[model samples]
Target chain A: MLQQYFGELETGLLSAIRGSDGLVNPRKLYSLEVARLGKRLCSGTSPVAWCGITAPFDLLHSMGVTSSFVEFVGALLAVTGVAGAFIDTADQAGYSSDGCSYHRAVMGAASQGLMPEPAFLVGATNPCSGGLAAIECLARHYSRPLTVLHIPQDESGGNVAYLAQQIRVLAGFVTAHTGLPLDRDRLREAIENTNRTRAAMCEMYALAQRVPSPATSKDLSNFGVVLPLFLGSEAAVELACAYRDEFARRCAASPTTKKRETFRLMWIQNRIQFRQDLEKLLENEYKAVIVVDELNDVTWDEIDPEEPFEGLARRSISIPFNGTMERRVEHLQKLAREYRIDGAVSPCNWGCRQGTGARGLIQAGLEEIGVPVLNLEVDCVDDRKYTEGQVRTRVEAFVEMLHGRSSPWN
Target chain B: MAVPPADFIGFACAYTPLPVIAAAGGAPYRVLPMTESPDQAGRMLHDNICPHVKRILDRAIDRDLPELRGMVFVNSCDAMRRLYDAWRRVDGAAPSVLIDLPPTADESAVAFFAGEIERLARTVESWCGRTIDRSKLSKAVEQHNVLCDRVDALTRRVEAGTLEGGWSRLQAALNLAATTPFDAALKHLDGLLGEAPADRRRASDPPIFLFGNVLPDPDAHALFEACGARIVGEDMCTGSRTFTRIDSDSTEDSCRLLAASLLRRPRCARTFDASDPGRMSQDVLDAVKRSGAKGAICHTVKFCDPYLVRLPLVREALQREGYPLLVLEGDCTLRSMGQHRTRIEAFAEMLR
Candidate 1:
């Protein structure tokens, strides 16, 4: 079913590209790349690995392993509307429904033999504990070797070295499974590609900071976070470059585009993947443009290829979700100031203990900077719990409250 | 010279080293979940967080806990980390230190965790307004080790079906050790052990091995016993995990030894064994084998991701070994646990 879905998506994306007279649609191209990855995973031709969201994809890709985080499959199952069945399978198997739906879906898929069996599993102690647990379960289910990167909360010198050493150990673990040694040149190339992707994404985010923001909420919904799956490849760099050009064009043409820009909002954490109506409702009815996403910013500097492990370690630890709440709030405040957001919307993704766990702190932090926040107590993946009407009412009330405030644009 | 009243340092996770807190001139007070607290933690943290964390936070928000001089938290899992985050916001003036605990027990991780423990020692010393004496720390380690030895002996009795007051008494003693001062807890444990009947053995009840993250409620254990099962052993953070002896070398650095010893314990689900992915399930199997149990029971808290995610494999491992496994999920409440009485009875019946 996954193969067929991705195959159809690849075909549909190809048709859209051809029909557009070969115009480079970054969104379509990005989808095509992901579809190809999905097909490759389903094909089971390459050595695959199931990893946590914060695992160094570049390192894995450099070692000739096809890897994607378990949540990617969870999100895929969710958006494709088959997550409910998988979640039920997991639920019936005694997995708690109170856990993250993303993991539940993946575990269910694994139980149903829907997930591609990987040669090994890599779990990272960042982002969330649920992801690590899911990875461990997958490793146990498939009878595969597992390597866990214990990403530290404090990004001190010793912590960074600890993580870097773990990354090296991870590479060793991968090599033991795949019988492939770590190639220095390939790692260097992968790091270079990652640097290029980061540079383009930084440019894209800069262009998105325009008065009438070029990017739409739909344009970059989960684009920044998911792009890392393709980080070590030329495709990631291309997708990023295309996004930068697209944002640049939109920014240049913004003055006469007749785009409604009443409230420039900041979307916190991940947007809902199973539905499109929320973004449309916020954009069309209220003219509230999501100027930035919490994860869209480039938080780390360029990686030095010579010291790739150290650089990757720093990047992984520097993610807002990995560290203390203060660090996450500080990053959110920076984004709020840069994007000049009127208000922030925190979906407070249900069962997400790491991200939604800090919902109160995030709200308080933003409000401290004179920005109001609307926390939608909704599940991003499990649509079963999402009441659209309630979400619409809350969003509308939030927008109304924002409208009552004095506009900086005026 | 008379010892002054011990300043109480509140902690949540079992990963927080009690000896370090004791050495820093503070009584290690484990803040456990209580059903009496109001549901106010959801306002600060998400409602779907681990019930243990939420209840702890609720206690803090409601000011239902005792006067704590400081707080120590371990970055053991996401829920614990969020609890630390929420605790700081709810009680900003209290001196709190969050130790970055590594999930793996590798050498590098041990070293890193040792540094974190050392950092914790400094912060705790500052909070207590005195430097941590190495001799005092060594003595604390020795005392804790002796306490662990006594608990192990009592645990052997529990496993051999010879424990005097059964699992409830053991759980109560463990809870006392967790919540009270080191000397007082040790004394209580010694008292319990000295009074325990040696020859009387519970032979008819089904011997069941229990495992999960945290099951601090002694009544829950009593419920299992009432349901016609004798809990031979448990691998919970509040039980065996907390009581695992810290083998200390007086010549070695105490913090490093403590870090090593804590990591070496039968790991919580939050800790991963990279070298052996199947070690967690195997650990359960080993415990079950040692206890001579006919069945296994896992009592995990609601919204506890670490245990919830790994439970299927545990069930599979037990099933492969021809052991019936019963998993019970509770919201850190006796009422939630009460709902599982029929199921536990059925499981106990099947084992018999």
Candidate 2:
């Protein structure tokens, strides 16, 4: 069923692109690339790995592995409206409902024999313990080899070397499993691809800071976070370039073509994958556009191909979510200022301790910078407990409150 | 004139090295969650976070805990890390340091963790206005090792079914060691061992091995005893895992030696053995067999992802070994354990 779903989605996306005379938007390209990756994973023609979100996808792609984080599968399940059944399956199997729904959905799917068997598994101990726990469970259930990267919170010289050594060990482990040796040339090329993608993303994000922001809530929803899965491949570069071009065109377009931006907002953490109505309500009803997302910024420097492991290790540890709350808040403060954010909406995603755990600190940090925040205590994946009316009312009231206070930009 | 608060350094996780704090001229105080604290942490943290962390944060928010000179936190898990973050926000005046503990116990990880421990020592030194004397650190390690040896002896008695009162007594001793000064706890242990009674468990009470993240409530253990089950073995943060012995002679540097010893201790679910994904379950099985347990009971706190995620594998291993397994979810309160009374009774009966 997953194979057929991906196959149909891939075909439909291709047909849509072809029908539009190859005038593809970044969102369509990104979706098509993800669909293709999904189809390949289901095809099982190559080595497939279920990894943590912070895993080095570029290196995996360089090794000819079809790898993506487990959360992507969960998001796919949620967006397809079939996550509830999987979640129920997991709950019945004695998995706690209090755990992250994304993991629960994937675990449920794996139990139901809906997921493809991977050759090995890789986990990273950063961002969230829940993610690594779910990955370890999957490794045990599949009876496969697992390599966990112990990402330290502080990115000191010793810490970076430790992580780099582990990444090298991971490369060896992947080789031992898939019988594909790491080619330095291929790895260099992959790093080069990532550098290109990062440059394009920087331009795209900067263009998004325009007065009538060139981006929309749908345009950047989960875009920055999920784009890393394709970092080593040309798909990521193309998708990023398309976004940069689109944003540039929007920024340079005539006044009438640009969308009215009454209030520019920032989205904290992840947006709800299954629901689009909230974005529509914010855009149509309140004239509030989410111009930036928490994960949208280019935080790391360009990876030097000569010392790729060190660069990758530094990038992995430098993610805002991996380190202290002070570091994350500092990053948010910078985003709020650069994006000219009026107010922020933090969807304190249920069961996400890494992101939502620092709810009060994030609120306090933003308010310290005179940016009010609205925290919606709702699950982004599992909508079973979500009350749409309550969320809508909260968002509308937050927007009204923002209107009462003058914008910081003014 | 009012006296200044004692030089107490509060901590929450089992992974915090008490010897370093002791060497730095501070008292190590393990902060356990209390049921009496109000549910106000939801204002700072989400409602779905681990209850252990929430309750700890509640005490900090309500100022229900004792005054401390400093706090130490280990980056053990997401909830624990959040507790550190929330605690710093709630009690901004307390000088605190968070040690970054590596998840894997590899050589590289051990070395990195040793550096983190050294960094922690420097932070604690600044907080206490004293240096961590090497000789003092060795002495502290020796004293901690003595406590561990006594705990292990008591644990062996429980495993042999020769110790009276089973887990409750052992838990009380461990809790005392965790919260009180080392000398005071040592004195209490000495008195308890002097007056220890032989096993008086009934034949109908099945021996069970228990495992979880945190079960600090001694009443919860008494509840298991009331349900007619003898807890012969346990692997909990607040129980056996807290008393890991440090090999002071392993390395010249006290911090490195402490790091190596702590990393080599019996790992919790939060620490993963990547090379052997089944190691945790196998460890539980081996411990259960060593204890001659007829069944196993896993008591994990709700929203504790580290333990909750690995529970099914542990259950599978226990079942494969012909052991009946009972799983209980709680909120670090005796009330939550009380709700599982019937299930525990049924499980004990099934084992019998």
Candidate 3:
């Protein structure tokens, strides 16, 4: 029953994406793909493995484990407009409602038995302790083994070396649990696929820097949301290629939209996933295009397939938000300059300490660089925590502030 | 003959290797959490950060730790890691070093942690301008162990109904022992040992185990006592859990032993032993059983992911053992003392 609901939604979305106009909205296509993937993962035909956002999906793909991420599932529920119910379910189950919406929604799903029982859970220490803690609960609830990646906070070579050792050990753990050893050649191929996807994303990002911004809010937002789930896979590469092709075609056919991108904005962290009309509101109502977001930036050095494990270890530690707040601040300033952003919006997602904890720092840093930032306090997944009107008002006020500035992006 | 202010090194978290700082000829002063809002630090940090961390940052921003030659921060959680970030930005803040404590303490983890401790040792040595001999480290470890044993002995007496200064005083003493220099802390413990025992025990005052994040403030305990309960034991980082014993053999390396002991110590939810899902909770249960407590209170700071996540298992285990458990959320402030008081008193009344 649970599988069919999402499967039917996926089918309907696919039809919507394939309407008579032909490849109308990339957002609908992305949503359709996400729903379809959710259906397949929840069907329980393949061995399911639950992981945090920072968990190495490349290795899991190589090992033939179907990795369903906690945050991705939370975002899926939010987009489907069922995350609030799950949040309430988690609250009833004694989870503090102020906890991260993504974790809480998934916990609610686990309580309702909506989530498929995974063969095992893999948790990493990169993002936040709260997320790891939530995953621990699911592991115990489902009586599944949980393999952990102890990603250190420091940027020292020793820390990378330590994580590399752990990644190797994790491979062994995946092997023991799945009864299949990791094929080195297959892992290398997966890493290569990720590199290809990264190259394509780079092209799309370059296209977004065009004065009018080739991509729409919906297009860039869904692309950012799904990037983490599809990394190191053929599907991810294909999706990236399709996105880049569409972006290039749009730039050539119509250099600018009718509304004119008056304000090029950079969104920090995750978007408000539950508000289905938020992207449209920003574009149609405010003439502000989210030209870039923190998640979309390629912060890590390119992964070396010859030394796959170490490269991945390096990549995980080098993520902008994973290390010191100073690193994230530096990257935000860099993105602001490169994307010609007139302003930035940090959605201070409640309960997400890893993402939202540095809001003040980011704001101060951006302000120092002459870029104003508006901090929007909202839950990324729980719609009940915020109203559309309040968010729209805030965005309007921010855009109004940007209109006063004489930036070239305007 | 007075000790200079620069002789001390301020440190946060119970997992920081205090003996190394002390052995390197520096006083390891504990930086306790403040209940006041950190307006100065607030400018640099988000409002949703842990209050305990906010207070720590506030202190740094206010130059409250002038006596420190430097400071050491443990990468214990997300909040602490960010605390390190904010602490570095404080004007006139002491030079800070972060110790990356691993989540698990398996052989490889211990080996890695030992290297980290050694790295910290070198940092401290540079600050104090003195090289620490292995013998000095051994001696410092010995003093720390003696202090832990003394604290443990007093605790055992209180549990056995032989010694009693009330739970409020005991918690305060533990908090002091946690922060004070080793020699001064030992003197304080000795004085606490000499205090007169209560003449009569209140049979109706239920003994409860208090465990969770740092609850260093004595007022929290006083509230529990006023509600007709005795905090016979604790599993808090700033409480008895810091009184971890080290048993280095004749030939064992002190750094390696310290690493091993820390891995085996009663830790918070942040550290997970893959082999034991209930290790952290069992630590509380063991303390409760030893103290003959009738109930347990797991107080956590809001958004304290480590403690909040392990709560369901702890609650379930305590319930299965026929002991009621109350989980309280605090923000390192007594602002909600009345509400907390009501819940605590009601729980005590239930136990009675």
Candidate 4:
């Protein structure tokens, strides 16, 4: 029943995005392509590989495997308001309530057979422990071949070389399972496509740092899903171009002169993708806007097509969570300074030890640097755990504190 | 606090290279799970991390670490990797290193692990301010080999129903051995060996194989005993898993021998060989068959991802082999033991 609801949601959204012609706007077209991919994943076709976002999708794409991140499915359920039941199912299936909601919801989905059996499964040691653990259970449940990428905590040369070798091994593993060798040209093309998307994302973020902040949080809520899942596709580049152009148009407009662009805030980790009025509440009630987030920026350098495997390996090892806590804190500080942000918020998503575990340190560091941070304890995917009244009160309090020091009213 | 001459290098997982630490003139200390409030660690790490990690960090945060030269962390799980981060943030006295362990033990994995061990050896040598020459490594291997042999021999006696107490006694003894120097561990085991066996055997007490995190207290085993069951064999991180003997004859390359033995040892949930998905479950089954056990118990710590994630599959595999499996979760507390006692006693009754 849950999968059917998602299936209908995808079909409806895809139809609207692809009405008659391709799309009236490129932005809708990108979303339509993404929805199409989501629908296909829900369709439970063979040759699909359920993977973590940190896994090398470029190589999977090169091997002709339909790679879908489990988190994406969890987010979809959250968006469609069907995640509560699945979260309950997972809770009943012995998952700890404190585990990340994203993983639990997907684990629940798998338990109910809402998720299809995959040809294989791939996971990595990055971002957090929850993803790998969830994938291991799913792999075991489905009896699929599981490949786990172990990224070193530190980004030493030896570690990079080690990961690079693993990426080479991953290609062989995928080939052995799928009987399709990764084409060097195909991987290079994927890398080049991803580089284009990264360039466009840079353009969008540059526009976003303006005084009025061109983009809304809702507009970019799906940014996390698109970049990690669709980076190697043409739609990803088109999506970036759409965001860049829309933000540029918004920044160059004339209606912002009379209104107050009161406060600019940065989101840490992932946004509350389920809330319909969250961005509006911040914008209208508090006059604060989430100009950027942790997931919005691309710290990855331009992928070198000449060395596709090494480039992907370098990108994999370079993830902020794969490194020290200081790296992530420093990156947030830089984002704060560069974006001219007043405050920051971390949702401290359940079941995510990597992001939530570093929250106190991050808050302390940001506070030391003259930026007050609110560490909100809320599950990102499961709204059953969300108390909107409490969240609003805390967020309102945080906004008032920011206003007391420097108000947009003045 | 001044560093002790025999500065023990604190390690978390069982798969960490203990023999190498010994080779580099440091005693390898396996941090066991204990029931601690973790108030200090909670101030640093979130309270929701696995209880085992929380307890380990609690010890560090409360300044409960013994005089140590340094710490060695393995990339075994996410919680452990974050433990290293939190340790660095606390600015502890001892320097730390993370050993990047591969998931599989293929040829490439062995080569990578050997290199990692050599790097660890270099780090330890520098810390102790002494060159661990080939002779020192060889001597350490020989000493460690004898300790392993002793542990294996003791474990065999217990499995064969010759020794008297529950497996918890063996677990506690191994815990002491893993945390001390070679000779001290042997002496402690010798003392246990000197105790004459009592005829405590019962045909109705169903023999069972046990596995998972460190069973720090004997209360768990005592509960099993009360439930009319005895652990014929254990695959615990602190039990038989630590007793595998390496090839002491290959003294020319101690690192290679250590890496090989680490692979050859009974596999843990955290250390996946990847060549076979059912290999770990099969090994546990083989151990169960070898010991003539009727059932198995996989006791795990709360939020322990490595063990918890693998439990369902291990349970399924074991059940398919006509072996009843019970998965008991706890935080290594007396209360958790009580909660598990009812379920354990019931399982034993069902087995009977």
For this target, which candidate reaches the highest DockQ against the unseen true structure? 1
Q: Higher-lDDT candidate among 1 and 3?
A: 1
lDDT (10s digit) by residue, model 1, range B56-156: 88888878877788999998889889888888888543668888887788888888888988898888888887778889899888888888898888887
Model 3 chain B lDDT-worst window of ten? B33-42
Using alpha carbons, what is the TM-score of model 4? 0.91
Question: What is the alpha-carbon lDDT of model 3 when measured against the actual structure?
Answer: 0.79
Candidate 1: docking tier: medium
Can you tell me which runs of candidate 2 are displaced by over 4 Å? A257-259, B1-6, B157-166, B196-199, B250-252
Deviating ranges (above 4 Å) for candidate 4: A1-30, A42-46, A91-98, A254-260, A406-410, B1-5, B35-38, B161-164, B248-253
Poorest 10 consecutive residues by lDDT, candidate 1 chain B? B193-202
By DockQ, is 1 or 4 better? Answer: 1
Best by TM-score: 2
Model 3, span A1-410: residue lDDT tens: 45887789887986776673765455565666677668868887777888877777887887888886788888878877899999888877677766788988988898888888988888888788887887778888887888788887755858878888888998898888879788989999999998998898888788877767787776777465467677778878877887788878888876447365877888888888885576677778788888887888666666899888887888788767677888889888888888888889888998877777767778988887788998988888988777778877888888888878888433
For model 1, residues A1-410, the per-residue Cα lDDT tens digits are 88998999999998888899756768888889989999988987889999998899999999989999999999998899889999999989878888888999999999899999999998888899888888888888888988888888867758888889889988888888899889999999999999999999999999988888888877888886898899989999999999999888877788864468888999999888796598889889999988899999898889999999999999998888977898899999999888888989999888899999878888888888889999998878888888989989999899989978975334
Clash list (residue pairs), candidate 4: A99-A351, A100-A350, A100-A351
Candidate 3 interface CA RMSD, Å? 1.5
What range of 10 consecutive residues in model 2 chain B has the weakest lDDT sum?
B157-166
> How close is chain A of candidate 2 to the true chain A, as a TM-score?
0.98
- Candidate 3 reaches a DockQ of 0.65
Ranking by TM-score: 2, 1, 3, 4
Give the Cα error of residue B337 in candidate 2, in Å: 2.2
Per residue, candidate 3 scores C-alpha lDDT tens digits across B32-143 of 8753534666687677777778888888777665467899999888888888888888788889998888788788889888888889999999999999889989888888
TM-score of each: 0.96, 0.96, 0.95, 0.91
- Residue B308 in candidate 3, Cα distance off native in Å: 1.6
DockQ of each: 0.77, 0.76, 0.65, 0.43
